[model samples]
Target: MTLTLTVSDDVRALAPGFTHVAIEAHGLVNGPSNEAGSALLDDAARRLAARLDGRAPHEDPHEDPHMAAWRQVYTAFGSKPSRTRNSAEALAKRALSDAGLPRINLLVDLYNAVSVAHLIPVGGEDIDRIDGGMRLIRATGREDFVTVSGGEETVEHPDAGEVVWCDDAGVTCRRWNWRQGPRTRLTEKTTSGVFLLESLAPMPVAEVTAAAAELAGLLADFSPGADIAVRAPESSA
Candidate 1:
């Protein structure tokens, strides 16, 4: 079955430069992090360091044009960008930190690598767990957002007017990539998934496509014979 993804008109108006590409894959082989996965993360950190070009690790990542654009969008939706940073910015911080990025699993580590290396927000969802088509919209603060807190299952609601990714079930990601709900997150047992790579203006759409392409390549290498397909970048504006 084909999965549908859409951006609401209101959200497009809020961020006129939003563009995203989705990669759908099946027959994936996900497992614990290994030497290969660790090497990929290491290379991604080096690439990010080179891109920063002498910027102090302690410096604000939002100073970069791409991150700044995301921050502006967050602010437009009543979110504090500093307190709730986009996934890419959050991973970039860890990449630059002495502690380094945490290795989740092979699939997660792979996408996190692309996110840090290209400085774009990338997320993956287990397709089998999704109830219906995914939509990006401004929430009314009443949607169910099931998440984990303190190792126990919990339910939360997004702030009114906040941007979120949802499906027939409820919110999949809240705060526009800041946090992903646990229900649809890809796990080690996941064999099919959809990956979304997002970007904003000052960062060309071609670059976002390039990042998606790189991710697709890595997925192919790591999950050989997997059926992987990438959708063209779609502009939300």
Candidate 2:
């Protein structure tokens, strides 16, 4: 089956400059981080630390035009910018601060590293767990959102008109680049997955394409035999 990732017409009208690069890779051997994976994470952490100097992401997430554009989309959907930060902003803040970044698994750590380094929202989901194709669209306030809260799995629903990533099952991510649902989250057991590199205007398509390429290359090196395909808004696999 062919997996597709797309933004809806309404989403386009809301943020015409918004674009994303989707990458699908199979044959991943999800496990502990390898030498190459650790190197990539270390490199990204160092780069992010240098950029931080002493500033916090919360100081002015809106300062980054790309992040500001995402905030606009969140606000348009009734979410508060202060409360809901995009994934990249949140990760950068943590990586730069004393808290440091969390070393999840091989795949999550790699993407998180890239996200902080590039200052863009990147999300990875297990494609095998997805019910159908993925999409970015405004919610109707009734889509089921399966999430884990306080260590227990529960079902929640997205607010009406909230921007979300969804599949045939329901909402996969809420508040645009905010939290992801537990149903399709990437874990150590994930062998086939999709990665999303989301960006906005002022962030050139070439840069985003490069980020996607870097991610694919890293995966190729860490997970030998993985079949990776990348697709941007203007380019196909």
Candidate 3:
């Protein structure tokens, strides 16, 4: 079945420049992280470093135009950008840090590589686990967001007016991509998945499409014979 994604009108008004591309694939070959995956992450870090162009290693990630756009969106939604950064900024900081990015599984590593190298937000979910069509919308603060705390399952609610990605099940991601719920996250055994590449103003739709293409290529390489489909970047505005 084809997975559907939509950005609500309210979310478009909140961030008029919001654009996204979706990649859905089946028959994937996922496994433990390996040498190739580590190499990809290393190369992505180098690319990000080059983009920084001598900026102080300790400098805030929001200095980048794309990240700055995300910060503004976060503020518009009543979230403190500093305390709750989008996934791309968080990954970029870790990539530039001495500790470097963590090696998750092959699929995670591949998507993270694309995200850091392109400096855009990219996320993957196990397609089989999604309940129905996913929608990006402002939360009512009463929707359930199932998560893990201290190794136990827990449920939390998003703040009213906060942007979230949800489906028939519940909130899959909170605070406009700040955190992904554990329910639909990709895992080592995942054979089918959907990846979303998101961007805001100052980052052209062309760049977003390019990032999605790069990710699709990487997925085809790592998961040979997988049926991959790349949707054109669509603006919420």
What is the RMSD, in Å, between candidate 1 and the native fold over all Cα?
A: 0.8
Q: What's the TM-score of every candidate structure?
A: 0.98, 0.91, 0.98
Model 3 off-target regions past 4 Å?
none
lDDT of 2 by residue, 61-158 (tens): 35667777777767877989878888987887676666677777889988988888888899999999998799889888899999888999899998
Segments in model 1 whose C-alpha atoms lie over 4 Å from true places: none
Model 2 pairs whose backbones collide: none
Q: Stretches of candidate 2 above 4 Å error?
A: 34-36, 50-62, 234-237
Residue 159, model 2: Cα distance from true site in angstroms: 0.9
TM-score of model 3 vs. true structure = 0.98
Position 214, candidate 1: lDDT: 97
Candidate scoring better on lDDT of 1 and 2? 1
- Any idea how many clashes model 3 has? 0
Query: Going through the candidates in order, what is the number of backbone clashes in each?
Result: 0, 0, 0
What TM-score would you give candidate 2 relative to the actual structure? Answer: 0.91
Clashing pairs in 3: none
lDDT of 2 at 102: 79
